[model samples]
Target: MARAKTTYVCQACGAVTPRWQGRCESCGEWNTIVEEIVDSGVGAGPKSAVAGGRPVALVPLAGETETAARVTSGIKELDRVTGGGFVMGSALLVGGDPGIGKSTLLLQAAAALAEGGRRVVYVSGEEAVAQVRLRAQRLGLGDRDVLLASETNVEIILATLQNGPAPDLVIIDSIQTLWTDRVDSAPGTVTQVRTSAQALTRFAKKSGAAVVLVGHVTKDGQIAGPRVVEHMVDAVLYFEGDASHTFRILRGVKNRYGATDEIGVFEMSTLGLREVDNPSALFLDQRDRDAAGSAVFAGMEGTRPVLCEIQALVAPSPLGTPRRAVVGWETSRLSMVLAVLETRCGVRIGANDIYLNVAGGLKINEPAADLAVAAALISSLTGSPLPADAVYFGEISLAGGVRPVVHAPLRLREAGKLGFKSAVTGRLASSDQGGDLAITEYSELAALIGQIAAGGKKQAAE
Candidate 1:
């Protein structure tokens, strides 16, 4: 008989170590290493009673194949974020902070799918059946012909799924709460999470059911578990929103069959999460047009163009090291923009407390918002209010030159659709016209700075 094997694994980063240590060298998380027995019964192991597999034929990359049909859940925003709809036999991992409405969104989608005559199974590991039913009733989806289960044992769940009619969609409330008899470690451990995910992914592929696994997020807003879980799934999405705000954003970071970096906006209400058909207007609603530090940014998320306000405040600081408080944007990007303004534009802006925010709680990731951020900062520094109808987008180089961004025509088209009359962007190709709006092209950041300062002077004079 082969001797049992034991190993130490880091719960935070899934790094395997021979011995336990104070902190994980990979993720720098403390006291996360745990010991577990390997080569267990359920999974594979060395010198075990399991048999070897046979080789299969390989196919060429270029081959004639039919595209798989997608199962629509009837929730437009959910379907949009999942690349038109959930593809059959694809596994997805969705992560979010607690109370951020991850369950509500998935529940809504499952109900929609069930109502559309698709067999849907919702297995809740975190909540009981009564709690889920209460929430479904609260969301007014109680009448939907959806099946629910409150279980966490992976074996039992798989057996249950296999015994019933093959479901079109299977939503697991959370992957962290799942445990398997194959892994001797506790639930939510690195081994268990990985094994459970692999089993479910295999199930999805074999049974042609779209598996949606919900995951909890850590304090740093990353999916709490081994990173391998993310790799096991075909797609990874994040549900993000602020508690104070009534809106939520479902963003896709990885997709094998669809575009990445896509977003779907939803508004939370007593009824449930409602899709925002026009996210540009939803993000820019109730704007303070006369605010000196506010500028609208025309940016893109995947294939969609989004317009949001960038607000800035620069005030004299009493402390030697002024505070740089930023929300909904990156601090390093802010620092880079500040350095460019001071070094290239000869602006003395570092000796103040700077605060920046993207209005309506929207987070921007693209570098195209550099021009908008700089404009907001300059506007606040000079007390100039950018035109409410004007939109800004472009990249700023360290040499203070404005670089053109992709999809300029699309951005301008979105601005025009929202009743914006003017656009300030980088040099546009001649073929790409302003399309019903006054367009201003800038090759250098200094030119826009001069224009904004001149506007401030002109406003002060008036």
Candidate 2:
């Protein structure tokens, strides 16, 4: 016979304790420790008969096979992010800031699946059933096959999945709102979230359902609950964008089924979120033939190629400290690059207050954008316009040298697609091999300026 057992667990970080404490010593969270039952004599700490869950070893290749077909979610950008489409029985957690269109995106995906004759059930803990209907109506989605349930009880949701209709795709509006009866903790508690997630994961794997959980992000921009939550799921996705901008990016941080670096771009409208197929064109500035302060950059975000605009404004500083402000870039990096420009390139930027920004509100962490930022600043200060057909990429070193960036081939291909005839970048992986692109290999900032001023011919010949 098994012994009756119970334990207390912290709702913040999944730290288990013998008794409740006023504050959690492990995570330093207050009033989070809650009492819950634990079945003793299990493989791990405790077991439960009612839980009725067990783990099985992964079968040999010959014993099991995959049956998932790549189905487009009707959003081209989204399909690109998921490495073509969602795999069967795969669980994905999507998190973002509030009003970032996380729920709307899920509903859009659900509608697409349902319209294609696939079963999709959306369980909501935040909104009412009619409210969901209204949202669907706004998105022009009136499919009856896309079922809705407004409940937060994890047990009830599982029962519905068991006895009632089984869906091909399941969506939980927000994981923090769900609660399990087995745990005394409230909804969004670490124990409840973990336990509920475990049950859903079991259901998805056993029943061959594709489950999508809409998770909430803390003030620090991390997914709420234990870090184990991300580990438990098959994939983790983050939706991000400025509140003032209509564009949003859905990026995959972890993907077991596909590439993790993939991203999807979308546009918000009165109808709903619309997928942007050609993100490069949308992110690039479209104006007259030439602009002095603006330069084009061919940047790579994972497997995707994106073109963006870098803008710069330079003016003489009035105070002792020159003001340096940058958007979508690192300020310290800007300072370093500015110093390099002043010393190596002989650009008059030391006493100037330089302001820089990427035209779109998109954040760029890739070092490949460094060349564009530097070139834009120099062009603005010197009042020289980079040719409309030229794009820049490469990392800027403190010594004023251009360093090689990753995925050079993909970056060049993307830039070529945008009809750029020439690119100023660091030396390619192989210096001798040059096919279509007229690649200018610049070892230093001074060399790049000479090439850019010579209209690319003098540098290409060198």
218-316 in candidate 1: lDDT tens per residue? 889999888888888999999999998999999999999899999999999998999999999988889899999999999998889999999999999
Alpha-carbon runs more than 4 Å astray in model 2: 1-71, 287-289, 319-321, 339-351, 430-437, 449-462
Candidate 2 backbone collisions, by pair: 11-190, 39-47
Residue 87 alpha-carbon offset, candidate 2, angstroms: 1.3
User: Any runs in candidate 1 off by more than 4 Å, and if so which?
Assistant: 1-3, 41-45, 48-53
Q: What is the C-alpha RMSD of each candidate to the true structure, in Å?
A: 1.7, 5.3
TM for every model, in the order presented, reads 0.97, 0.83
Residue range with the least summed lDDT across 10 consecutive positions in model 1: 41-50
Local distance difference test scores for all models: 0.93, 0.82
**Worst-scoring 10-residue span by lDDT in model 2:** 39-48
Q: Write the per-residue lDDT of candidate 2 for residues 62-81, one digit (tens) a residue.
A: 76676665566878877877
